[model samples]
Target: MTFNHIDFYDIPHVSSALETKTNSRINNCSSSVSKFILLGFSCTRDIQILLISIFSGTYISTLIGNLCIICAVRCDLRLQTPMYILLANFSFLEMCYINATVPNILANLFSEKKTISFSGCFLQFYFFFSMGTTETFFLSVMAFDRYLAICRPLHYATIMTVQRCFRMGACCWVCGFLCFLLPVYLISQLPFCCHNTIDHFLCDPGPLIKLSCSPAPTTEMICALYNSVLIFSTFLFVTSSYTLVIRAVLRVPSAEGRKKAFSTCGSHLAVVSLFYGSIMVVYVSPTAGNPAGMQKIVTLFYSVLTPLVNPLIYSLRNKEMKEVLRKLFRTVR
Candidate 1:
């Protein structure tokens, strides 16, 4: 999608000829332009080159990995169960999740001009967080699925039918986007006068909020509370579901059955930990007095690393997935 080309150098606040920026709301927050400079990974030329190379490879590998899972699940008849179906949905989500941040990151890394249009910034902000939220909901649903399959075996098939799984997936996508509307909308409406340069790669709420011309304590609190509720509720739900799952698995007489159950949950748990671990540090934890650099590191970890890890965690270790991927390779050759 093409956006209006605005030279970042032309940004009034960025120029040396600019008037001294003040805390005063009227003088600082009234930017008529529709762009923001994304200060993405400011480092030496050599470091930038190395980062570009690393993330380029990572991005390609992540895309290929997730796409393979989506294709394998869709093409293979035996893999059409609720678990694989949800896996495919998660794969698609990862694609979007990575795509939202990485491509712009690459573009910014390669060029000296590191700017994103205002529309693009918020679009990234909205979609990236929305995708994260969707993934959270999906994880919760997957945990519930596992809990049902392991804990209530007889009713599993009945509860998580093909139609039902699709419905749940759709609901996750819809709810994720809808839930954040108020917060994002309110944040976007805030007058950003301090400076247009976002310290992080994308339009993150914490940094974006700080650039506000005036202190908006109420808005900040509302956003924080909204995020806290979502993060804690879903996290607790997933944990609770797994607790029940562990209980059910322990009841199984055979060690083999227990091992099999754990194997399935292990991959998901790892992915969840990586995603939530980095995210909680950045978002759920105290953002009140944190340094921008710390926030940058935390955001980079989840936005770049987690998506890269997801395909490996989900697709590679599974024997059936390996077989499907091999067949796909052979067919292409």
Candidate 2:
């Protein structure tokens, strides 16, 4: 059966059939994609079940804790101040924050087919990052508030009026969301070739960029630059404020006054440390030779555990928040 003795035209039908089969697959790929598969947390079935239980408890506790903060702020007339108002806003953001990804995560835990629609993935991508950015701004806003209250106590009331605080909070949300729009747009317009699998849990930029056919260095650098700048700038602002706050507190000449000042800022500092520590490791640090599972663990820390711990951080040690919570619960009972 040597091909050298055969006429190539005699096998045109075979060639045509093979060509048709290849074309069919190509055509199938040409259709609009409605969904993507998420290969989240490579684990055995039993492990996934255990993870579901763990995440379910975490999600529920996060929800309840943040809700309690919101309720305490809303119910307590004594807490109708700028600080409490900002606290409530932050708690509300935390609720939406965890809500954006936790429920889907829980579903994927049990689902045989773990898939998310194209629109849903991008929406989760945008809102989740936007909320994180907004939180950075809010943290900076809070630091500024602390600065005013501690350094310029006499003018704090006049400078940080109720209306002004609300306006500043609104500005943070607006700017945070708007800051990443261009980068997101650029990423969205990329040609994602045949592969439609997302490697991570929540459509994070790193994993999404990896799935694209073409490398996106410029877009990635821009987004990373934005994240780094936002994180560092706000963090620096917070640090400076606390520096001045500590100096001022030291000058108070009374241990009670110094302790009081530190108490107000302790929770915020703890949260800032947790957030920046985990996020910097994931987004800003060099990853060329990083361990495989580290990113997921760091992301989980900031995204899930941070929210769950925030209310405890704020309320557990704060006499004011504790009083308000007890009163609110008593009133309900």
Candidate 3:
């Protein structure tokens, strides 16, 4: 895949020749890029099945766990508080986020052909971005919920009413979708005259940005700026919210009150820590050599493992949820 540099601004006749040359190169490249090879988990046959089984279990468990949260929150009238509502929303978003990446991965693992079409790849990237960003927003919202519950106990109900919670959830979904539209569009517009083989398991922005044959400095800069703003702003909000929460918890006169507050927030804090920590390590660090494998492992933690754990954490730790589940089982039996 040779890229011929043509100065369209300077040479008119040469520009025509360059256009023909570029067209020829593009046609060949397009034909060759009919299917993108996904260099997934392992090259060994036995290891591939092991990877498939692991991903399948993760996918099924994630779906079931999130669905349980949603069902429990909706069915149990006693659990209809703003906090549980937000928890249900987070579970739903996590389910969508994991679904966006896991099924394709499972399919690639089992099939002999590990190729994804160009448009298919872009669509995968789009959904992954949409749901991942939504998760980030939901996390921030959850943090704010905790902040209000702890810092402003008297006003918690008024501040996080049903209407307000619904509005916040909707905004999280819409804002995340809108934020990535420009970046996805910009990446789609660039001609892939270079290698089409994406190094990672999915069509992530990092790998796609590196494969652009044209001078993509502006595109890269735009992506980096957007990612940095999203990551850093959300981190700041979460940190500040939790800091206030900690202060309020400490000021509580009773040990039981402090313990309850910490228990309510412990799971969310654990998840946020894991997610942001891995993201900073993968994206914020300088991309000198290929870190695709390492990135995939970190990506799995957030994309697969986090979703799987949300319901488990909430269910196991929450007394209200446990009672609700028990009632549901008895009713079914």
Q: For each candidate, what TM-score against the reference?
A: 0.90, 0.89, 0.91
Clashing pairs in 1: 28-193, 29-193
**Which residue runs of candidate 3 sit more than 4 Å off their true CA positions?**
1-23, 30-32, 288-290
For residue 133, model 1's alpha carbon misses the true position, in angstroms, by 0.8
Tell me the tens digit of each residue's lDDT in model 2 across 1-333: 655687664798988888899877655663455677887788998999899999999999999999999999888788879998999999998998899888989888788788998878888899999999998988889989998999999999999999999999899889989987876787787666567887678888887777776688887888778778887888899889889988888899888888989988899999999998898888778642246477778889889989999999999978989998988888889
TM-score of 3: 0.91
Clashes of each: 2, 0, 0
Cα lDDT, all candidates: 0.86, 0.86, 0.85
Our model 3 lands, by Cα RMSD against the true structure, at 5.3
* lDDT for predicted candidate 2 compared with the true structure: 0.86
The model with the greatest TM-score is 3
Reference-based TM-score, model 2: 0.89
**Per-residue C-alpha lDDT of model 1 across residues 207-258, encoded as one tens digit per residue:** 8888787788888999889888988899899989999998889989999999
Which candidate do you rate higher for lDDT, 1 or 2? 1
All predictions: root-mean-square deviation over Cα? 10.3, 4.3, 5.3
Instruction: Please give the ranking of all candidate structures by TM-score, highest first, separated by commas.
Output: 3, 1, 2
Colliding pairs, model 3: none
Please estimate how well model 1 matches the true structure, expressed as its whole-model Cα lDDT: 0.86
Candidate 3 lDDT over 252-315, as tens digits, reads 9999999999998998888898888877777667652447788888888877888888889889
Q: lDDT, candidate 3, residue 273? A: 89
